[model samples]
Target: MALLHRAELRPTKLDLLAAWLPSRRWFHGPAGADIVRVAGFRFDDPAGAVGIETMLVRAGDGSVHQVPLTYRGAPLEGADGWLVGTTDHSVLGPRWVYDGCGDPVYAAALAAAVLAGTGQAEEFFEVDGERKYREPSMTIASSGAGDAPVPAVGPPRRVVDADPALIVTDSVELVVLRCLDDGGGERAGAMLTGTWPGQPTPLPLAYAVPR
Candidate 1:
């Protein structure tokens, strides 16, 4: 389960993305375009130290892009290039946000989800010390065999930012779809697909193939 606090965020997530997305080679939207969060889901960190979230955002021109982000209390070592920006969280204090593609925690969590057929985390909102269940903006499922075994994912040996961002680890190659297309993406191997508002049909989000 994922616990969220009812707190404010300085330069909210979208604001940070608006300035960061244009720099990515795979981002086709206008530079500095306004971005609005359309939908998203989260994967729990087994150790509960990192915050993992994947967001679908619509640009000013109606183009939708997928952005996977990870939040940390401190900067990730040797990941200066992948740093999205820093933001102040009311309850959590300072947060270091980075593109999840370059974070090993995200790579491992994603690989586990796809290879082990796990789903998104159950979310809860905490307000005044009380916890309330919150419905996820989107839902996801994996095409992997339920009984399949998942290999331990190591640090990313390489990260390529493209239409489908690639995270090449020692055990598998993780493909994260950067754009949302009606045609969906071609299946590669074990993959995770999601459905959100206005999209009744499941769309490919990410996939994993053995290294």
Candidate 2:
């Protein structure tokens, strides 16, 4: 379960993404385009340490992009190149945000979810001290079935210069879908997928392959 606080954040998430999104190779938006968070989903850190979220944002020209982000208490050493920015959370104090594609925690969590065929984390909001489950903006589905366990991995060593963003981990290479296409990516034959709000077709989110 994911509990969302009603606290304000300095340099709100959208603002941070606005500046950082254009830096990605997959970003197709024009400079200074209006970007809005259209949908999102989350994965729980089995250890309850980091916040793993995937946001689907739409540009003013109707192009959609997928951003996987991780929030940590301390800076991820050796991840300077992957750092998006830092922000202050009213309830969580300071946060170090990074692209999940480069974070090991995110890679492992995503691998587990895909291998286990799990969906997004259940969301809950606090209203007058009452907890209420709120439906997420999108639904995710892990495609492919197999008993092969997802290999455990350490910090991402590096990213490859490929169309589907690839992250080199300890045991495998993680492929993250940087853009929202019509859901036809299957390089690894298995992937984590998400559906657009009100849509039934699943779009590829990421995949994995042996290193």
Candidate 3:
């Protein structure tokens, strides 16, 4: 399960994206345009250290984009290019945010979700001294069998900036869709698909191919 804190964030998530999104080669919206977060889901880090979240945001032109990010207390070594910027969390203090494509933890989680069919993490918010269950804004599933075995994934060797960003690891190549089309990647192999409020039909979010 993923634990949540009801705290304030300086230069909120959307603010960070507004500055970082236009730098992406795949970003279709105008620079400095308003970004509205539509939905999101989380994946638990087994070690419970980094925060893994995937957000769906709509651009000014009604185009939706998927952004995966990891929140950490310290900067990730050798990931200066992937840094999304820093934010001060009310409870967690300073956080170093990075695009998940360059994070090894995210690669491993994506591989597990696609190859083993593990879905989004169940969430609970700590309210006062008790834990309160919260429904996820989005849901995800995989084409692989639930009991399928997942291969070990390492840090990305290369990240291609494209409409569907590609993360090439030692064991697998992961394709993460930046643009959210209702019928994205219909003929893809093992993949992770998601459904949100307006989009009830599952659409491909990411996929993995063994090297």
RMSD of each: 1.3, 1.9, 1.4
Q: What are the runs in model 1 whose C-alpha is more than 4 Å off?
A: 182-184
* Cα deviation of 82, candidate 2, in Å: 1.0
The lDDT of each candidate is 0.88, 0.80, 0.88
Q: List TM-score per model, in order.
A: 0.95, 0.91, 0.95
lDDT of 3 at 72: 96
- Cα lDDT of model 1 by residue, 1-211, tens digit: 9999888999899989988988877776766567988999999999999999999998777667889999999999999999999999999999999999999999999998888877888999987779999999998888894746798899999999787888999889999899886444586788788889999898888899977
Model 3: per-residue lDDT, tens digit, 1-211? Answer: 9999999999898999998988887887866679999999988898899999999997787579999999999999999988999999999999999999989999999888888877889999998899999998989998874645677888889998686888999898899998996456564558888899989988889988877
Name model 2 segments beyond 4 Å from true: 182-184
Worst 10 residues of 1 by lDDT: 180-189
